[model samples]
Target: MRKRGKYIIDKRMKFKRGYQRKMILKIKNDNNLTWKNLADEFDVSIQTVMNDWGREFATIPYSLGIRMIDKYLSKEKNLILSYWISEILPKKWGQFLAGELNKKKIKIPQESEGLAELIAVILGDGHLERKTLTMTGNFFEREHHKYIETLVNELFGLSAYNIKLKGSNALQTKFHSTELIDFLIKNGLVLGNKITNKARIPEWIFSKREFMLAALRGLFDTDGGIYNKQKGYKRALIEFQTHSPFIRDNTIKLLQRTGFTPSKSASNNSSIGCTLACNTRIQNQKEIHKFFNVVGSANPKNILRYKYFLKRGEIPLKDKIYKEICRIKIIRPFKRL
Candidate 1:
C-alpha cells in the first residue's frame, strides 16, 4: 500500500498515483500536447485522462504506464509511427528523430590524457543539447576549432562538421549523432538547457595528473583569457570564469593541485547564476614557461597572447589584436568585475 496524498491513487488503481502525477505534469509542461491526443495514444477515453489528473477513480494497465513514461521522455512528432504497431509500444522506442538510441555507454577514455582535455574544452565552450553536441569559437579561431574537431572524432569516433552561424562571425563544430549524445549524457554531461543545470568535471577525470593537466589546458584555451593590466610592464593576468559553481570550485582545486596558487571571487549580480572567477598573475619567467609547457592554450587568441608575452615581455596596449580583445571585454558582461 502506497502513501495516500495529493498524487496518491486508491489501492484499486493499477498504476501508482505518483507515476500518474509525473505523467500528468509532463503533459501539462509540453505546450503542444493535449490530453485528448494522449488518450488516443493510449487507446483510452478522454474521461480517463481527466479522472487520472483529478483524483477520480482511474485505472491504467502496467503497459500503458510504461508507454506514458516513454512518451514523456520523447518528442511525439519525431516518433517512428507504424500502422502495424498500434497504440501500444515497447517500454523504450527503437527510433527517434535524431536516430536510434544507443543503450551501450561509451567508455570515457580514462587512460588517455587528451580525453580529460577534451572534456574540459566541452565544459568551457561546448553545448551538449538533446539532439546535438557543439563547441563554438570565434571565426578567427580556426586552429582551436580544428583541435576540438580532431578530439571529438578521436574520442567518440564521430566526425564533427564545421558550421558558420548566420549573420555572425562565430564558428561551430557540431556532432549530430543520437548515439554520441546518449553516450555523453551517460558519462555525466548534462543535455538540454545546460546553463541553468551547470555541467561539472567528473570526479574520475581528476584521478590522474596527466589527465588533469590536459583538462586545464583545454579549459584555459577556451574560457580562460590573458590580459595585461599595466601598459608597459611585464605583468599579465590569467583568469578563468564560469557561471557554474561546480566548475568554478573544481577548477580552483585543479589549479592548486597543479602547484599554482590562485584566488577566487564571485560576482554580486548575474541573471543565470553568480559568476565565479579564479585568477593568478604571471609572477616570473619560470611560471610563464611552465604554463605554456604543461597547460598550453589551444585558442588562437590566447596562443597569440602567449607568444607576444614571450617575445615582448608584455602585451602592447597599441597592438590591434589585444585592443580588440580589450574592446570586447569592455562590452561583454562575462568580463565585468
Candidate 2:
C-alpha cells in the first residue's frame, strides 16, 4: 500500500542527562522564560519539559531537540546537536535523514535510451517501496549487480548499497530515496505489488525505436533466457517470461514491432502467467540475428550461450554450458545506447 501524508521524524535522540539539564537552564536564563513558556516554544507539554530538565527522561525526540537547537541556541552552541545528528543517531534514522537531505542531489533523468533501459530493468527484477528502490539478482550475478549499481549511480547520482541475503543465493542492490520512487511512478512504474497494479511499458517509450530497443534489451537481459530446443538441436530459442499479462502482451507487441515473430504460450502452472519465445529456424535465423544485433543482452549468462551457439552451431548441454561460462575470461560491460 502507498504511504500517506508527509514524512516525519518519529524517533528519539539521546542526550546525556547532565547536558539536557544544562541546555534547559541555559535557554531559560538566556530568554527569561519559565517552564510553561519553554514548553509552548517547543510545542510540548509543561510536564514533558520538566521531566527532561529533571533528567526524568534520558532522551528527547528528534523533533524537540532539533527545534531547541535551531530556534533557541546560537550557532556556536549548536555543536552538540550537530555531533548527535552525525554520530549518535540510530542507523535507520541517520539513513532517513541522509536520504531527505540528499534529495536535491538526485538527478532527474531525461527521457533517453538509458532511462528506458532502467525502466525495463525495474519491471523485470526491481521493486519500488515507500522509501527505497531495490534491484535483486542471484548471488552468482554479482558482476551484473555491480553493473546495475553503476547504472543507478550514473542516472540518479545516488549510491546503491548491496546486501547478501542470509542463507540464500539472493543479493539485493538498494538505495533510499522517495524522490526517485516518485519519479519512477510518474514514468509509469508502480509501488508495492506490480502485477496487482498492472504495470507495463510507458507510452512514451513506444514513441521512439531507440527507446523500445533499449527497453527490450533490459527486459530480456534480466528476465529472459536462452536454450536449445532438443539435446542435439542446432538452433536456439530465446524466451521471456512474466506473471503480468500486461507485460506479456506488451512484450509480444514489442517483439512484433521489432520485426520478430514471437510465439506466446501459457504456463502449465495454475499461476495464469505466460512466456514469449523467439525460435531460431532456417526461415527465422535472420530475425534471431536481428534480435541480438539490435536488442542485445547485458547478462553474461545469455551472452555466453549466444557466443557458444555462434561458435559451435548449437548450444551445449547444461553441464558443459556452466563449465564454459565459468571458464570464459571476459564478460562484456553494459553500455548506454
Candidate 3:
C-alpha cells in the first residue's frame, strides 16, 4: 500500500466492481471482446474475470489493474505510471483525456559564452530543481538578476520570470525549462540536490578566454563585493566569497591569469568558506581596474563603486614614461626625480 497524504492507497486490493467497470469501458473502447480473451491478454485468471462481472470479488491487486490499463492504452511497458483515470469521463471530455498523453518536444540550446556565464551565476547563487533553474539575490542587486534574464532569452530563446518576495529584500528569478536542466547536466552541471552534489566549472571553458571571462564575471557579480571604508584611515578593497573550494580556487587562478595578485583567507569560525581579497591600495587599483577591463561587474552596487573609484582617481592608468623614468633613476643613483 502506498500512502498518499492523509489517504492510504491499498495497492494489494482495490474495489473489484469499480476497477472492472473502468477496465470494461477501456476494453470496449479498444474493441477487445470476451472476458476469457481479455483475461488471457492481461494474464489474469478467468475466475477473476467472472468475479468482476458478478461483482463477487471485494478488491483487485494494484499490479494487475495497472497492467490491464497499460495494455489497453498501449502505453510503454517501462513507464511506471503513478496515476490512472479510474473515474469515468463524459463522452465530450474523452478527447481532452486522450490529448493529455501527448509528449512535448523541447529544443535544447547549443552551448555558448552567454550560456556559460549563466551557468556560472547559477553555480554561485542559484539552485536547480527537477523542472527549473532559480537564481536569487537581494532586491538591491537587481542588475545581476536582469543580466541573467537577458542571458536566458538570448541563449535558450526563453522568457524567464522575476518575482519580489513579500516582506523580504531577496528577489527570485526562475526559468521553467526541463530541457534547460538537461542541457546544464550535459554541459557538466550537477542536477538535483546541489549542496551534497555540487558541480564544478566545465574544464572546456578554460580554453576559451571570452567564455572564461564572461563566466568569471557572472560568478564575481553574484558572489563578490567591493569595499570602501570612509573612516579614520580610509581603505578600498574587493573580495569574492564562496563556500565551494572549487569555485574559490578557480576564481583565484582566473585572477592570476589576468595579472592580479589576491590573498586568500578562511572565514570566521562560524562560517564554512573562504574569501579572496585584494586589500592594499596598489593591489586593489591594479586588480579592480583589470577586472573592470576584462571581467567587469553586473551588480549595480559594485558597478557604482567601480565608477566612483575611477572618478576619484583611485584607480589610475599606468603611465609607461613615468614608470620607465623611475626605472632608469633606480638603475643610477646620479639620476633624480
Which one is best on lDDT? 2
Scored by lDDT, model 1 comes in at 0.60
User: Which scores higher on TM-score, 1 or 2?
Assistant: 2
Clashes of each: 0, 0, 0
Q: Which digits, one per residue and each the tens of the lDDT, describe model 1 over residues 1-337? A: 2211112221222334354445465665664657677656655434346443423233444444446646565554233222112343222233332233334334344447777887788888887644457777777665677777777767766666786755777777877666677666665577534456666777777788877888788778777877775677787777787766667777877887887777767764454556444333444446556767777766657766766787887764324684444332211111111
Q: Please give the RMSD to the true structure for each candidate, in Å.
A: 12.8, 14.3, 19.5
Best by TM-score: 2
Error of 1 at 38 (Å): 26
Q: Worst 10-residue stretch by lDDT in candidate 3?
A: 328-337
Residue 77 miss distance in model 1 (angstroms):
19
Please give the lDDT score at residue 204 for candidate 2: 91
Q: What is the lDDT of candidate 2?
A: 0.68
Q: After superposing candidate 2, which stretches have Cα over 4 Å from the reference?
A: 1-104, 268-283, 316-337
- The global C-alpha lDDT for each of the candidates, from Candidate 1 onward, is 0.60, 0.68, 0.57
Better of 1 and 3 by TM-score: 1
